[model samples]
Structures are given as C-alpha cells and as structure tokens.
Target: MATSPAAPRAASGGPVRLSAAPADVAALIMHEADLLDERALEAWLALFTRDALYWVPADHGDSDPLRRISLFYDDRSIMEDRVWRLGHPKMFSQNPPARQVRVLSAPMVEASGADTMSVRTKFVMFEHRLREQRTFGGVYLHELVRQQQEWMIRRKVVHLVNRDTVLWNIGVPI
Candidate 1:
C-alpha cells in the first residue's frame, strides 16, 4: 500500500480533517462486533494491525499496563495463541462454545489524524453456556489506523464495569 502524507494538524495539535467519515467508523466498529459474536476469530484478527494491543484493565484507575495488573493484555503473538485455543476442537473450555450477542451504542470519534482515529463506544454483551447466562457491560476504546484504504485496529481497550470484582468464566473473547 502506498503511504499517504501525514495530515495537517490544527494549532491545538488535533487533525484538521478526519480521514474517515463517521459512518465508516461506525461500520468498522459494528463489523468487529459481528465477527466476534459469530466466532469468526481469524477474520476478526485480521482487523487488527500487526502490532495491535488488546487490553482489559483490572481496575478503572489503572493506566500503565506494564506497571499495573490487567485482566487481559495481549499483543499479536498472544492474540494468535488465543485464536488458536478458541478454535481448537479439543479445547475443553469451548467444547460447548458459548453463544454471544453484543449490542453497541453509536461510536463517537474522539480524535482524528491523517491516518489515525480514536473512537469510544458503549456496549453490552450477553453470553450463554452450560445452562448459565452472563451479562457484561462497558466501554470500548479503539485506536484505529488506516492501512492503505482499510482501517485496522492499533489498540483496543475494554473497560469492564465490574473489572475489580471476581467474575465467572470468560472463556470467550470479549
């Protein structure tokens, strides 16, 4: 892919114009949700850039992932392992794979640059397995970067509302 020149910024250090339209941004977010819900792990992994980071903070107040304990923090290598585990038929945890449905609010673009955008969205996910149902709600913070013509996730932070509390099995990706 041909690299585009860096976008100009305003005096306040913000992008003067967004690289993607709001609708496009929302569509990407929705597509990601669908991929996860459908258990299309490989396709979902393709949405992320090679160096992407996926994080779920253990505490709402936690900042630095390296210094603070996180519920889940994964880079490309870790993500690949996770994908493999989730897809493996012998993985007992997923023997009777959980059924999940995610509902997301409108994604709001918080910042934009020549090739990057930051988005925030609220979501609630319901998972059912082994005759038990679980609900999780939180915000998704995505840092997306345009690679050629497609937007890829550079970082995704999942802030669970009940992060600090002990939770049941989260066998599937959130």
Candidate 2:
C-alpha cells in the first residue's frame, strides 16, 4: 500500500501526510457497508471507535451535529440499543427482514491531521422487502483513525440529497 508523495504544507504552516493506505481505508468502509447490508449490526458497531458518532443530518452542512436536528444521531450506547432491538424477536419490523444492497464508490481521501483522516465518498443503497423497494443515495463524510494498522471510524456523517422529504421509514442503517 504505497502512499503518494507528501501533500503540500497546510496554510497554517504544518506538514500534512496520510499514514494509512488508501486501499485499506476503502476496504474498511466497504466492509462496513457490507456488514450493514447483511444485517450484521453487532459486527458493524464494533468497527466504530469507543467514542464514535453516527449521524445522518436532516440538512446538508448543518454545522452543529448536536444543535441541529438529525435523522439519526447515535453514540455507542445508542447503537448497541438499536442492535439489541433489531435482534429481538419482539421487533415486529424484523418479522420480515429488510433486504438491502449497498454500493460504495471509491473513497476520496481528504485532510489528514495526526492520527485522523477525513474521507468523502458517495453511496447508493437499495432496500427491498414486503414488495416495496426504496433507493437511497448520499454522500458520506467519515472521520477515521489509524489504530494498530487498522482504520476505524471515529465519526460518520451522512448527507442525503432529499433529507427533508417525508419517508415511510428509515429503520435500517443507510
């Protein structure tokens, strides 16, 4: 996994370089999508760092994740709860599990700071079940950290093009 030459110094007068392999980063995100599509919520949650945040903003570039309303804003505890409910027999939605397929485009590595790197990518997911099919397309913004030769998501922010539109339900991860 060879990296390109060091990026030009930042305007703030600091050297910027990415320590993680691009392919590795790409694979990590791809695997995450696969896990979600496969309904492996527990495995998917494990890929996040302890302090990780998962957010789907209701508005594009909403700035403040907390103050601004979001479709889904979850921490580790919340994610665990979601997984638990998803796995429970009482969870009516799972009586007929949703079928899903996700396609993630090649990741574009952005700014690098210390152990963290920002990534931007596009994705399209098709979810079908009970004779209904819903397609979702959006841009994903991820803050990733290199830990012991593996890249883990520190924060994930999804920006959907039609975020404000009323939807039937977004029960599953997008």
Candidate 3:
C-alpha cells in the first residue's frame, strides 16, 4: 500500500543552533576515553558538572529513571566516594587494580537541545586479570553541556548489550 507524506508541523519556536563544532565534541569524547584508559579517576570525575549523574541502566527498555534500579546511579557525592574508595588503602579491591582497556568508536549526535546534546557511541571494553579478560561491548548515551568554554558531562547512561548476566564487580568506571 502507498501512503502520502504528511505535512511538516508548524514551527512552534525558532530553529536551534549548535554553537560547538563537531570536531571539538569528538575531541572532548576522545579525552574522556583517554582519561578512563589511563585510570585517572580524579581527573575523569572532574569532567562532570556538579549536578552530573552517572548511570548504567539495568534493563534495555527500562525508561523510568525514578522507580527502576540501576547498575549504577551516582551523583557528585557518590562519585567522590567512589574515587576515594578506589585510591584508599582500606579498599581491598584496589590492592591489585583491575587493568582495563576501553575503545570508544562510532560516536553520533543523537539529539540536540538548547544547551545540551545527546550522543550515542559504540564501545568495547576489556577488563583483564591474570588469565581472564572479560569483554563488554555496548552503546553509551551521554548528555553533555557547555560550561565555561568547555564541555562537561551532565549525565552518562551506559547500556550494555547483555543485561541478564551475573557479572563481577565493576570497581572501575565504565
């Protein structure tokens, strides 16, 4: 069956313009990846805004952020705690740090609002120990904002392709 095209909706507001360049956005993303790969937790956390949120959703189709539990849902305070724990001598998990390598690719601009942009990117991360290398591949949805001539993360939502597996602790930031 053939269908006729619908008419375009009337403009409720003026067209939006993006002030940041694509190259700059890509550079910021690359820097973030580098920071994680280098295990620079403090520096990595600094890239987030004061009201930033870091989340790893528990299910693929789960959209209610308030009711559903998450793999991780951290604000600045929680993020600070995590950073402190990672470097604290009392943290047994840090005795032998889990080595990790993350590769972020195919970043595409998904949406753009007034002061925020939503980006989706594919990633492959390998967390390795003596003889085991656990690999995770998924897409990351980032809500970023421009602040003081720099782009900082407002929210980072990681969606792992596999949601039903019992996994080891993710001591390090994904």
Task: Specify the highest-lDDT model's number.
Answer: 1
Separately for all candidates shown, the number of backbone clashes (residues 3 or more apart, or on different chains) is: 0, 0, 0
Best of the two (1, 3) by lDDT: 1
Model 3 per-residue lDDT tens digits across residues 32-124: 888888889999999999998888778776665578878888988999999989888888865677788889875667567667787766788
Sorted by lDDT (best first), the order is 1, 2, 3
- Give the alpha carbon lDDT tens digit for every residue of 1-174 in model 1: 101113346899987653344888899999999999999999999999999999887776567889988778899999999999999989998779999999998886667889998887779999888998888988888899999998999999888886667676675678
Clashes of 3: 0
Ten consecutive residues with minimal summed lDDT in candidate 2?
1-10
Number of clashing residue pairs, candidate 1: 0
Show pairs that collide, candidate 3: none
Backbone clashes in model 2, listed as residue pairs: none
- TM per candidate comes to 0.86, 0.85, 0.84
Q: What is the C-alpha lDDT of each candidate?
A: 0.83, 0.79, 0.75
Cα lDDT tens digits, model 2, 1-174, are 111222336679796543444788888888999999999999999899999888887876576767978898999888888899998988897669899998987877767667788887778888898998888888877889988877899888887876777766687778
Query: Largest TM-score belongs to which candidate?
Result: 1
The parts of candidate 3 lying over 4 Å away from their true place are: 1-21
Worst 10 residues of 1 by lDDT: 1-10
Q: After superposition, how far is residue 69 of candidate 3 from its true place, in Å?
A: 1.9
